[model samples]
Target: MSGAAPMRVLANATELIELLAGEGALPLVDVATRIGVPRPSIYRLCEGLAAVGMVELLPDSRVRLSTRWLALADAARAGMLEWRGAPEVLAHLVERTGQTAYLSVPYGSSALCVDWCQGRAIDVLAYRPGSMMPLHVGAAGRTFAAYGVPLPEGDRRRRTEKTIIDYDELAADRERIRRDGYALSEEDVTIGIGAVGVPILAPDGTLRGALSLGGLVEDIRKHCDEFVAELRAGVERLSGV
Candidate 1:
């Protein structure tokens, strides 16, 4: 007799998170369409995310991810690694390549360096803990941007003459990065400093973060294949594969 009085469960927040992540910033309509949920339900989920610092509601009625996710990810990294991120893995890369290695995650519309291990031969430190880089500036940042993270205007503005400030060029680079599963920033942030970056994705295919190794341009280029292999191994380990 009560079969007609069936209860309904609400959509999980993770669904909303994964949608926003795959499509980048989007208006409620896009999310609703993608998830086959009503616009109002999507709006409600977005509102909840905005309240929790997981997302930001734009004046243009779009929703974007907030930087707070980075902090949460760092917290989760605890006990997994001695600190936050694949420190032991990064150390291995440093040992193999003799370059500074780092783990970066989306910081609002930018990229934040969560953890790093410096190589023995390095003299300059490009990104240390708490150091933020514009999403269009470096390998790590570009990795996030290419994988659906929004790039801020500051990243669009050139830092040095070598930086890729042109939107068209950046778009082209994004395409390449998407296809390759990795990227190289050739002095795009700082002269004489270059990096190779790979995206770290959650099992759900959401972009959780990125990993990068920075050093001289030629050095990274010389060991590009090796670095990518090591980086992939590190990612597999970090992911508990």
Candidate 2:
């Protein structure tokens, strides 16, 4: 097979996995339709995934991810060496602030949430494990920009009325976050939700990831300073500093 053939198959396989992960079991025809692959190709892809133990072919000709993914997920978390101390830090932040805490690392022009601890007060469902937030919005995304990760080009996505999409405004926000050592967002991603984020820096000062607290807009805005302090403390603990 030519190199392109394998790359195409790999891309299709990845898309198939993400589709099943999001939508649960579905008929092979529907999977093909949703993924824009041919029906025959979709079936082959499903068979390949099942053979690899990544997914299961249901009795009704539908398919779903296999239980092996649970083990894989656990293994992935454990394998992320930089985030070795993340779970304890996330738990402590949630306990300290009573808000959802997330650990995200830069992935291309987006922030990929690797782990999170749900808050006691409310669930801010905008970000979760495996979810991606773009670099120009959200506290975690902006923290990457603040730490010198360049933003993706093109008009910024307008997720909410309060989302800052203008390049000049985003430049200012990045500068402020750089100066303050944290980023704060108020209803930028989801209405009525707010967040505070701080970059997790290595001892040599490279960006490791971002730690964030998210909750109700008013609550987050009201306690922004305190949240920044708590998140920084968590980063300190994670870094053993």
Clashing pairs for model 1 are: 67-108
TM-score, one value per model: 0.65, 0.80
Question: lDDT by residue for model 1 over 118-142, one digit each (tens)?
Answer: 8776667567765677788888888
Candidate 1 is scored at a TM of: 0.65
**What lDDT, from 0 to 1, does candidate 2 have?**
0.88
Model 2 per-residue lDDT tens digits across residues 12-107: 998888777645788888999887999999888889889989999998989998989878878888898878888889999999999999999998
When summed lDDT is taken over every stretch of 10 residues in candidate 2, the lowest stretch is 15-24
Among the numbered candidates, top lDDT falls to 2
Q: How accurate locally is residue 224 in candidate 2, as Cα lDDT from 0 to 100?
A: 92
> How much lDDT does each candidate structure score?
0.78, 0.88
Superposed Cα deviation of residue 162, candidate 2 (Å): 1.4
